[model samples]
Target: MPVISPNTNYIRPSPYRSAAPPRSPGPTPEEPLPQPPPVVLDDSKESTHEPCWALDAIRYSTIVGAFSLTSADLKLLKKVPRGDYEDDDHHDRRITRTQSQILSRHGQRIDFGFGSSGRLKHRGMPMYALANAPEQELYRNMSSGGTAVMKPFSLRQIRVRFLWPLPRGEEPSHEAYDEWVRVDPLYTRVQLAMAVARVFYRFVEANRLYLSQYHDYPWRLRPDVFYRVWLLGLERVDTNVFVADLKYVKDYPNE
Candidate 1:
């Protein structure tokens, strides 16, 4: 055995140092990997973000009913990020990004941490966390309603789980505070997607037309034109003239 000196430097081999020669390539092309069909989960695998079909019918009916009761033309409200805690009493506390990422919702938040640490790490317990329960309008973790609307259900918990909570302490607009818990962005977006699917299923079930008859038709040709606009499932959006004509409704009271 050679005695190695403590001060001697050792040279590391190059990463690709194998001395073997490359083999000749085969002429045939490789087969492409197959893609999987999309999955739609049922209630057994439901998450807090989703409402069941029966529940959705009841809830959506209530909301639509409430809108109908307004004698004057109701200007539909615009959705904005509401996951902020300072604006509402839902979030238990003001939370760090890591903590809020756990529950993955856009609503009046609890500022509760979601991950394994299961704590309100930096900001301490949110004021809402100490509250016995949230206000009636504020939704808790439940997807029981969508079931009634006959909506398409996809597994979104995985995506939602890692999503960060809304930024705390947004600018106070009197208009913003009044509707704090009315229309949550994430839930509305998801609900809209379901509404679109429901129309398609209705068309098929009613035998108004075969899917092949309108397979290539634009989604515009579908039933209940308004529901198509539900649950955009995205944030920080702008609508240009090319997108959709802006109809100015009398400015909403909150605005």
Candidate 2:
């Protein structure tokens, strides 16, 4: 099966705007949060299901290590068709859709743009829903209204962006450091939401497989049956611990 293309420049282009929106009043306006460097996964290995599974195993291990999830939390995740994580275009679409949903929510809008240093600059909202909302809420919003085949590499890269704390700003001023500190929690929320969305997306896709087994001949699965199966997968997650991980993430030292 095709895996994510070898090209590693996976960051989606910043959302387009006619002109910069007016800044809303909030805590001392934060300098744009520092951006993470591009992730370059080694694609030298022969393209095969084994290599894909290896990468996916690493991702699952990383997720289990970072959060308070049991192996059982991913019961549904394991069911997703392994081949779905190979399309580059699908990855782009999902990322774009996710960004649009977050930015459109009722709150101060953020415009991500390249700085002179060629890094992402988060400008506009001091406290946006992406940073402030509960991870589960964000996940629910993000997971719905979209269907895209996501690749492991793309998913891994996106998670890394949110998983770790942002780098310190260049300015020596305390304000910059304060801004990083404030923005860290926001990332924590987004990180979990994005993870949830990833898993949810897989469950949605897995519906195709689940429905197929019921009949030897191809038939359109009823919407009710389709939704129920997908939702069942979600219901299996331990949301309490999932949310508690928010606090855990805050205290967890950033390496």
Candidate 3:
């Protein structure tokens, strides 16, 4: 081989010269980095937010039973009226939109993330992770003369745990464990109505109703309806109209 001078400017030729030009590197900072769209989570699988009318639903149900429910409530429990959705210019667009969404997903399997009896999975979590238990009431044990404390069997327990502590001093004699555990009929009835409202909402959500439809439904899933209205950016004017018009009874505090 001929001796090559180290000072020569000869460059080694690349075999890829005949190949296609290399791809451009990613966009530079000056080019705004071609920002990707923000990630949006699909809340269609679960309820985006609990309803706003839950307390009112409970309060009213306790007083008048089925009479407390509204036309929308009945529709949710049974079937949506043809006129409710047929009108494009319906006064309440929220309802119309919700109905449209439900119709769009006429057939699909829905997983509510909980069992049919409304019990949530414990998965080794503390009871606090579960839904809050309902308030306990005192029931008079006519024979024992000692008042029995009881509460509704809530779907919110982490396990089959009794939240209420048994009486310390006097244990009322009963033929069965459930005898003293018997809850107020009115309370149980209201709780069942609340359960119905929840199931119905899940049905609507499974059918692809807008996640925002949580508020549009007649019943509120959480107690803070007004707060949710603000958080969801829903107009108070519309929400005001959605409020159930049952006369308030001072005796039954909206507790």
Which candidate has the top score in TM-score?
2
lDDT of 2 by residue, 1-255 (tens): 112222233222222211112242222335443332222456577654654434333322232221332334233221121111233221111122233344342221212111222111211111122333354643444323122322111221121111111112312110100011112222433453333333322222333333333342212221222111111111101111110011111011111
Error of 2 at 111 (Å): 26
Candidate 1, residue 168: how far the Cα is off, in Å:
7.9
Q: What is the per-residue lDDT of model 3 for residues 40-72, given as tens digits with 9 covering 90 to 100? A: 333445655534444443423331222344444
| Tens-digit per-residue lDDT, 216-239, candidate 1 | 322212222121122212221111
Each prediction's number of clashing residue pairs: 29, 1, 5
Would you list the rank order by lDDT, best first?
A: 2, 1, 3
Worst 10 residues of 1 by lDDT: 173-182
Please give the distance, in angstroms, between residue 139's alpha carbon in candidate 2 and its true position after superposition. 4.9
**Native-referenced Cα lDDT, model 1:** 0.23
lDDT: which is higher, 2 or 3?
A: 2
Q: Is candidate 2 or candidate 3 better by TM-score?
A: 2
Off by over 4 Å in 1: 1-80, 83-192, 195-233, 236-255
Reference-based TM-score, model 2 = 0.21
Q: For each candidate, what is the lDDT?
A: 0.23, 0.24, 0.21
